[model samples]
Target: MDAREAYSIKVISEIRLERLGLLYGETRIKDNDYVTTVYLKDKPILEGKISLPKFIGDDLYYVKSEGSSALMRQSLYGEPQKVVELGKVLKYEPHGKGLLILGEDPLTKAEKDAPLVTSKRKYRFDGRGLLRTRTSLYLFDNKLRKVIEGDFDVTDFSTNGKRIVVSTSQPDDDVGLNALYELNLDNGEMKRITEKEGSIVALTMNENGEVAMLGHDRGKLPWAIREVILPEEGKRFVCGNTCGSTVLTDIFDGAKERLIFRGDEILTLGQIGGEVNIYRISDGKTEKLTHGQHVVRLFDYDGESLVYSLTRPDKPSLLVRKDEIYDPNPNFKGAIPEKVASSIEGWGIITGDNPTILFIHGGPHTAYGYSFFIEFQFFAQNGFNVIFANPSGSQGYGEDFARRCVGDWGGRDMQELLQFVQDVKKQYNLTKKIGVTGGSYGGFMTNWIVTQTDVFSAAISERSISNLVSMCGTSDIGFWFNAIESGIEDPWTVESMDKLMKMSPIYHVGKVKTPTMLIHGEEDYRCPIEQAEQFYVALRSRGVEAKLVRYQGDGHEHARKGRPENMIHRLSVKLEWFNAHLK
Candidate 1:
């Protein structure tokens, strides 16, 4: 009954030719029944809900049940945001009035909750910013007196409610890094408070609503906690990990306010790994409340217990937080992977510890979990160790760890990975016969890693960028973000190009000694196949064992998005290559 044995050569080839073009994966809603999303022309996006599941995101979230699905979109007012999704009658506050956002869903149930959000537009700043969700106002409503709404951005509040602090008209422009301000609730006056540049990672507000404490990004993570008293100098705290493992701490451990919070990174110190809680600072004595694996950064702490989401691995490719984590009818049917070791926070070998380790991941920003990364679990079922780590640049921790790769991709991130692999060896008793595989940034890392080190016995680089100069213009996002994020844009600029080439694996293909495999969809725009083709040709020309895999019309995420059978085929080929090279 082996899953790999179920696929026939003919079946896989048929899938490769037919199904490997679009997002055609089968989700097993019931036993042997497959489901996938249907984004028909002008239709509300629908996923087969035979078993009924919920989909949650940062703001735009939906919870669909047996026949009826309820959606909640954040109102322009504050947090505890609300959206309307009563059978696709998408009623949302577009500008002033509640208009139809999503017309209607074909599938309807008997009844649903249609609570109309009464808009009380308390305009302060002229809404001249982007209509993007990031700028949309989100706050926990405490001003109206009742717990009706909000959990808004806690970064821009004052200590007295009279004068609000806000940056200048060009606040966000130079705020390339740390930019926060306070707005006067009464006069609608913006006070240009702190001029730090970096992404604001976390923020917490005091009971008075006067003091909006912020957690600014520190290039190195676990973040060092700092409380910026609005329009004044920030107060730095020595919080975070001293070592590798996570230790629970109280919330108000740093300040005089006894807001018992458990944080690994107190925003100023090192990463003291553990979930952070700040339910009640309790006369300055810290008490750790809330039981969940990941720490819910205080979105906003009211006068009562700290209100935040609870995150844990309970489903496929889905990290559940808040109430959704405790959904009665959860998504996944099998067990998700738990932390294997303290030091290695998000990286570990699958417990079943399958031998053919097919370590697959993307992002260099995306973290792997028991959530909906089905391919990892499938690899585990197919007898692979399946090691994944949230390395330096992955999200979910905070701004610090996420920014560690800025201007330094192969330096610290690579070292952490080497340590991660060593940790895997110790934790999972893994051998050096490791198979390194990934896509996009991950694939870039795979290609980059093979060129620099012989740590992995075999490498599979899928849809990766091998040349930095070429990638600058070729990639869909190459013009700006890819460089700014990587701390390397304008590849043509002598200095920037030097930085790009320094990190690019294509520059030093002579160093690669491992047998590697290159897989790509011909139409991939993110990391084109030309990079893979060049690497393969070099490896083959250099008398090293290498193979190139190309799929027609498949883009960057096609291997996962393509048809079910093609997906199964990609799985088969990846595993087969690892079996031939790693096993």
Candidate 2:
């Protein structure tokens, strides 16, 4: 299969409900062009380079990018009309007969002339770039009115006509914890509501002023499973001890529904092992509603019909409404990965042949499950067997397992990965030629593997971490992530520095003999492009086979949401390198 075949795939995401019926979004990639279409009741309603389409009453509201971003509204069978100009609209919700939007305000003349200055601990984010402008929630009634601005960022909010609950974090506070505030819709008065330490990613309210949220308290480490919490009642419900939302995926679907209220029952998506399904909680009892090996990316229920977007190992995303299936990419003929049995418990292998590629997921907390992975499918189509596993520090497993790699990044988890590879190679009678590749935490492991042993024939480290000491000050979340992940209160301390150095791959780069290829996004603040640069220089200085591929203007999410041409070029380059080294 040609790497260019990636253009043939289409993905459906953000299953929602409108006044008429089901509403969803579809994305299509063809050559260098990327197009998105909005569908209502299984029919195309609006099509453009727009995103985050929502139905407020009988009108469709969405964000469109034309040089900059503009909020556009279109009625049923009517033309799209521009509502307002916004700077990267993050979210918008219906408020009474108007709208409540959260986004960055346009730069004023004075602001644009002023130097970039900040007193905050963290000033940058991975995908959103810089925090130069403050995010604010605005009310768009007859005229635009500023409701409130975030000290850092306004993460999420929910309203019930009379009042609204907003979740935000201060600049100097811990990024893991967010404070919830309730604002009066009439008087504009606001008060903090949360009396506990937790982060609320999503929230919903009932007519009776009851609020339920999907978040975690970091009780199970930084990657704590998100559970449904009722702050007013001081009660919480676990979704099988798993996350109450979908985990990471390569496909660029917009945000998924985390928590919603179906009358008195609370509905959420639960991740367990290699599957994500729908779960309902009512009267202190939790029940799984849907069962399958596939991942339900997005869903909406209206007391009767249950509509959702699902993806399997062999399928791209398709919308399912009751018994009817709506596939956006019906003509996609790309290669699909076939699941194979693995000797290692909780590991997954997609069959192909010799010269296998062991792909590692990024989060170390995020898991690879029974879902469609375009990258894995691309490798399989190009004649390479793919193997992946959750290891110890992954979610969807129990809390203990999810936090196993905490304070032990390259210790037990690294050893287990090495053992799993050897065991799988022997079990499948694989060839000696094998490649190791990953991004973020997986990238850290790839760099570590090359340093620890020369078992791999080739290595591709993307947006990886090389030096923990440098990462403490460079990466976006490094200030706190380093301390939490390393179990060190202060990473700058001499003793903690020693521990961090021992876990850093760059410390042991002298032992690396495997031919390595470093890929990085120039704008990636999460791992920082300097990480790849340092490793590349180190390898080249030692006369080892090495190459560095930098993607200009792309960020940490380049692999999943970068421009179509760059994505295709990346795949082609990887295939070429693997073919030359392994084939």
Candidate 3:
């Protein structure tokens, strides 16, 4: 398939089992505009520029953002009606007999007219952009009502109809650590449940009032493997060392149920040996329920049957239940990545000894596994062998492996990646010419790799970080992420600055000779576009071959969910650059 063909392939973003024994799935395709289609029983029921649809009772509820944000519902026999006007709904779900919404409150007249200023450390987030107001929980029974409004921001929440458990972050402490609180819907009273400083990624409550949380108590760094903790019982359930959550993937933004309660068991997704699968924990023993070489994106269980959306190396996303398969793009054909038997775990597609493009995944914590990547398939279809690996810093291994390259970004992990490239070349007897590309943390490694050695014929770094000092202040999570990742407690000190510089790729850019291209979005707050600008200027000043492509009105996820034209253009440019340099 060509780049445009790959872009046109429909991907199943989400799947859920309706109470009426009907399967609900959401799919997305991009051409002139991104279109989302909701399916019930494998038939299209709703199609438009809307998203996050769910069926509550007899009404189909969905969110529309064509012009303004609004929650609309359609009954079985009536047209769509506006339930309420949501200013900026972060998350909403069915709670008890009403709907619980977490969103930014509407701005007041005086506050909107006043100067925009905040003392909050995390004043901006990556996907949501700038944060001007604190988020509050609103309950809708007969009408929309603000139930829990506070000075803090809610991270994750769970409810049992009558009461709600919310994880909140205050202004003083680190934004990554949150405190749990229980809020009563009857009297609007709130009480702190946990006094420990930790991060709760997801949580759920059973009917017996037992709460299961997936988080760590800062024993290790932020990349610590999340455990299932019974907060009230003060007992941590040993599910496994690997985290039971989905790693970073570009295909979909579906619901990730990290921790959920079944009748007597706790079900969660766990990554092991580069594959994410479902696991069930009961009687203090963890059992792997599903097995295969595919990444499970989202899943739901209805007592007897389990329905999930999974993607393989050769296939896009599809729904699977018992013996039935609900593939959204059944006719779309593409290349498949074969497992590369090397000491370092990896996979690749060989195009008959063609010039290999070594791709690295972002999230020094996220591993590259049995997931379908459109970008890789596009490169392979264009006559290049695409190869990727899970180096030392990647997750899905043990906690020790995940934290190996925590403070040492370019140390062992970089060496292992270079070694893996050499092993692939030797195993396949390929040419010396090779191209390297990656985004975010992978981009940082690409920059670091070129500075260390010139083995690659070309390099493309997308949404990369070049300097740690500037990143600490510029990036949205930089203040805490950089400090914790680099093992520097006091980032503002002179000694810490020197240590961070030594680990940064920009400090060693003068030694780079590989032809490099930097791609970044103008609104990327995670890496910030300035990181690319600094590296581009450094390479140009040194008279090294370099190019920078900037996408307007896009963020760090430009390559994944940007405009269709921009996504295709980015792929074409990559192929053109690699062909000119390597082939």
Candidate 4:
């Protein structure tokens, strides 16, 4: 790596991730002298983006990012050009404005004269939030009818908007933990809409009016979204989880009034599979949108084109756009590549012209999405078409699929995944020198893949689990979840820990020949640092070409939230490793 490449996270090294504290990201390709960054400033810390010339200097500073509130400008150090306080507006506002997400020790009498600096809270997710156990909500609108709040959670609407429903929850065990309640926008009466004991996963309302869908916490399979009964006449599909992949497109009415739009192997937000099928409420005629198998997730459907994301083995999420459907396959214009199916069997293909891929997504439950992935795209942008699959253990599918990896961690699931990779490579005719990498469970798989086979030329394992015996105790989640996932209560008992060791990659390190890179955080409690350390130690001891990167102060999500320097360093090392091996 070039020495000129210097970058830092906006937060101080000793600082931990705060709920509302500003986080900054920057990348300077030193050899190219191009500095690209994203940041959010203090107080107004929402999100910011940076663009610098190929050349660098003191004048070469400042990053601009548009947030939910306003666009912000700040120095690389996160010093803002102006100070403007927002009203702290929130939707589905939780914890109330009164809840102290971040705190500071009471200022001493002498310290009162000094500026009062506060500490940031640890949990803050603007999109979908972490669901604890299920709780009830009382939806009561303000006297004005436009504002509504319920048992600690609230939703506010414009004064003109009619009756509204607000969703709220009480803090419980983190899972699909929130219940969606219907509120009378006028009378302020609330009724719980979700009937199942499990939490309602997501909510979607259509512009056509009177039409809505709610996806529930189904078994973690390919996700499946259920339709809700609306009034006496209209039936709508709920938009929570679609059975196939993580990225389920929004639900909508089909060409016929009674037919509901949905598809298996969905690729985009509004668009679905190769044969777009409309399910009829009256008789259930499954009409096809197309005649072939295609991958999909998010897609724009109104006037000009349809856009969406897709999932397949060897890739994660992909973008596809089409002018019209049903006539001919979309031919992406220049700058965008045509989509192709995976080489793996039993997997769908994605539409794109990106390079051949080696995608590594986190979560045995998490799949790829439209959300910004700063680190993943580095390879995609550099000519690697990304690919990955659920392989029966991903979330969004249903509980059955997700739980499949529960007690049976190293069972048929991994074997199916191995088959998936091999099938994808064989079916797609991708290079034999495949690249593999992942984080957490994915990282575990990266380690497992190398030990199981030498098919991949290069591998990257981040925040991985190398030894279950050590991790089950050291992890913060050790107190409760190990029993649930490992099928045992005792941490070190021979039977329980023995099964864990069976799934651990540390025991198989001696069999690895793939040039591997280990990336981990110093503070990751979920997988713990020992997991990475054990694997690295084992690999190095066996004389396998391997490197260990420990990001100071980082936890499980080391890559995204790791210190900026570590981010750049990890990326550089990974890219170099990939370039040397895959390229």
Candidate 5:
């Protein structure tokens, strides 16, 4: 697509979706830039005014405009009715006789100036702009007036008309995991429902307080659907093994209890097995409904059929319908790489070989899957064998496996990754030079690897975290990201800071010998570009070959959804850097 032709469309809501009537919002290129508009099917109904539209029931809809704190209510055809003012909303849903707004409150002068860490050391955070604010939950009545409020970060919630089940996490926990809480809409009371060790991914409750949830327990335990006869007492039994990431879950009564969920159909990285699929669990039997290589998202299940979207490696996303084929760019032929699934000492790898790049996926919570990735195909086309692995910290594995890297970021995780490389080398008997690259957490791994050993001639670290201590004060979510993994309650004390420093690659920069390329997005607050800068400077000062490549006006996700040309450029830079140094 031309720079002047890029566009995006989002479907509004599922209120009356079964009736087959649809409302969509579009953001498209105009005057060589992007502007948002709303549409009714194929007709352009509203333009150059509103964006982020959400349907309210069947007759009304809500939309918010840029730089405005008010959400405008409008009719189906585009007539505006009323403007409802609210704080910046991060997430919300329709709730009992009103709207539920979950966002952050405006920071006060004293609060804004307060140090993030309660230490007397005066850490360097000034001029770094405002820190990420804490989120709170607010209830707006049917009249769109504020009714109830609380200081909690609501991650997930499900309502049953009268009651609501919310998953919330406090900032001080530093673990970044949410626990189940029950919110009584009638009395405006909230109570802790589950006090378990693991995070609650999905939850639903009956009037009796009996609950069913998709739980990801600490370390090695895979996400599972569990039944809690006494949820308020925090007791639960695993009902079914959910091999994949559990995204959504619900329950229904019958002769036997049954749970319906939409999650990954296969647990593997998609290199060898399945996709994000829908399932039904009844009588302790889990049955998968759809099958294919494509990633699937289940929206609503009508008694007759399920409304969904399917996306594959070679095509754009398509809604499940009579004519669902969509290929936005048909000119270029698809690059289909062969799938090679292997396990080295229990760790899994989707393999490619010699002149190969051992790519690590980010998140530690996010997995590399069978879904289409343009970057993978580009590397394969350029004659690079790609071997991406799910090490101990990767999500596709059970929660225990993922939890194994929590307090040991560069320890066992690095060892397992190294073993994966050695095993792949021996299996393929490759003599060619090897390269390595990864973004975010994977980027941190790349930095750690180069410092630990120079087995690889080249390394590319993108959007990385080099110094955990400095990062805690800079990156948007740096505070919790460090605390949770370090198992430290406060990151400012000398002991905790020492631990963080030891874990950071910057502390070991003098050991790095591999020729490195440090790439980052300038505006990335997640792992700020300063991370890349410091690493690059340290490498260069140590007489190691290094280059810093920064993408302008781009954030953490530049490679995936940034400007088209910028994405291509980022990939091209990676290829060029590897091609130049790998040999």
Candidate 6:
């Protein structure tokens, strides 16, 4: 299957409601990727081609970002004219007869020399080296005159031509906090809106400027989908008991105003989970459009129809609609593994045999739900019962549970994972055939688990961090991620360094007896490949079986977006390791 990244989806021409524009990147090697735009109408038939980096459209014209620059076309089918020299436009929208672009400052010669700045402060993480870019909000006239410019990292924003609502985190704001502000385009006056705790992101406003925002309040667990009516009561929740974090992706206001969002539910508790869903909010009701274990990317609703791409455990993604579905990888047919969905505490069983594999998801903040996971399905289809859980520090639960492991990554989260393993073993009458594997923070946990106990027959840690002290200086965002996630004030201080070393997996590697496999991407800066190298060496020096597999020219997300052959090779390596040790 070809690896691809779908960028933007927009309804073109206010008069021609059915014409749609999509920008995406694809490659057979999944390397040397290039971006291209395709126009589609009522059916999913291609109308024309307009290649660009990023794009958006309105009635009379289409605005596109041409590699850190701007271009616009007045007609639906016409050559794009240079609009302005905007640098790396993250997002753009049609405002009145003008345009509002959220982008970074133009690159400078100094920045090009040494882009990344390492320090004890700064918590944000991006694939690109980080000095922390404050994505400014630019209001431009149709003639490309910049009217309004502001210094803030734009989280989300919406405008109705008269007023603009923006959610931003200023330079002085805390590591994870974002504040809401209303920007006046005419006079360029800015007024702070929400001053509450937690990050308020993803802004959506109707034609009348009725704003709805996604608020991840301090004490609230689920992301609060709230309606904001300023000057009196600031915000009120529409729904937050959905047991998952709701992210507002895109919203449109036509005759009927609508908002598009993504979230998940824990179908079968400790076992078969992960369902990333696309939702519609309108007229006092929340409607879930797609079901089953699937991942939806770049979904948009245009009043009468929905257009999106979906990926599942057994199937690659494709452009899909109500009347027709387009499969990009039609030849991607594998052994379809059986899936059983259950409650959070209950089990989602893909029945196979004893000695099942216990998989852990990354992002001590993210989760494992009833979604189609390729790795899990691969293990299950290969005669291994794969059990995973959304332990403490994961979203979907409430704030307390998610924040429980902040200062203690391996403490409660380890217990939750092991306890879930015990539950699965007892329920399924499993023996010593259990193996464990995870990447990133999950990789951190895998490293943590092997040091604490040798319950698993085999272990695989991918793109993991073993030493917090070393990771603080080496990782792309480790300077802050290590301490902030550990609930510390400063990572470089003696007290914090001592605690970090104690929490680091390398400190306890002497006790690890389980055969371990360290798989990493050579180019991973998030959890640099050196982290894996250190762990593999530690295990080998202790006379324990360990092997390191490094993927060249790959980054942190090798399994998800790396070359197709590399992804397959990763699965094969994990499979071979477990098959050798567990069997």
lDDT tens per residue, model 6, 1-583:
2112211112221112234444332213323332223444433312222223333444333334444545444444565566656556555677785778776666776766765654434433434445445567776675554444444357667776667888776633425467677887767677887666455545566566666555444422222222322322343433333322321111110111224322211110110124555554444444455665554544555455566654554554456667677654565543444332322432344564555887777776766553345565566656777777777776655556667788888987788778878777666666658889988888999999999998898999988889999988877567767877877878889999999999999999999999999999877888988899999998999899999999987788776655456776788778889889887
Candidate 5 minimal-lDDT segment of 10 residues: 248-257
Span of ten consecutive residues with least summed lDDT in model 1: 9-18
lDDT against the true structure, each candidate: 0.46, 0.79, 0.80, 0.45, 0.58, 0.60
Model 4: weakest 10-residue lDDT segment is 250-259
lDDT, candidate 6, residue 509?
91
TM per candidate: 0.53, 0.95, 0.94, 0.54, 0.73, 0.75
Off by over 4 Å in 2: 31-33, 108-114, 171-176, 331-353
lDDT of 1 by residue, 1-583 (tens): 1333332110000000011111111223222223434221213244543111122222323333333434444322444333333332211212111221222333322222333232212111111111111121221232211111121222222222233332221333222234556643334344545555444433333334433333443422222334332334243332322211122211111111211122321111122333333322233232344444444322223223222322233332221233433222243343356465634455443644445353545666545533324555566665666666667765446557766777776677777777777777777766546778878777888888888898788888888878877776666445454567657536568888887877788888999999988888877766767889888998899988998888775676555444345455677777777878766
Task: State the displacement of the C-alpha of residue 305, model 1, in Å, after optimal TM-score superposition.
Answer: 14
Comparison by lDDT, 2 against 6, better one: 2
Residues 56-134 of candidate 4: C-alpha lDDT, one tens digit per residue:
1221222232231211234446555421212122222112211111111122346435543423121212122221111
Candidate 6 lDDT (Cα, 0 to 1): 0.60
Model 1 alpha-carbon drift over 4 Å, by segment: 1-290, 294-314, 317-347, 350-361, 365-372, 394-401, 481-490, 521-524, 551-555, 559-566
lDDT of 4: 0.45
> lDDT score, residue 217, model 4?
34
Candidate 3 per-residue lDDT, tens place, 1-583, comes to 5567777667776566777565465656554566777777777788877776778887888877654468889997899998877656666778885999877665556755777677867777776566766677888887998887766677777876666888777523335577778888888887888867687778887766677888776633666877777788787764445756545556644545557676667777877766878887787778888888888877777566778878888787877888888777878766777778777898789897899999988887888888888888888888899999988888777888888888899898888888889888888898748999999999999999999998999999999999989999999888878888998788999999999999999999989999999999899999999999999999999999999999887898888787678787888888889999988
The candidate with the higher TM-score, 1 or 3, is 3
- Model 3, 3: alpha-carbon shift in Å? 1.9
Clashing pairs for predicted structure model 5, backbone only = 219-399, 219-400, 220-399, 220-400, 220-401, 221-399, 221-400
User: How well does candidate 5 match the true structure, expressed as C-alpha RMSD?
Assistant: 7.2
Q: Mind sharing the TM-score for model 2?
A: 0.95
Candidate that beats the other on lDDT, 1 or 5, i.e. the better one: 5
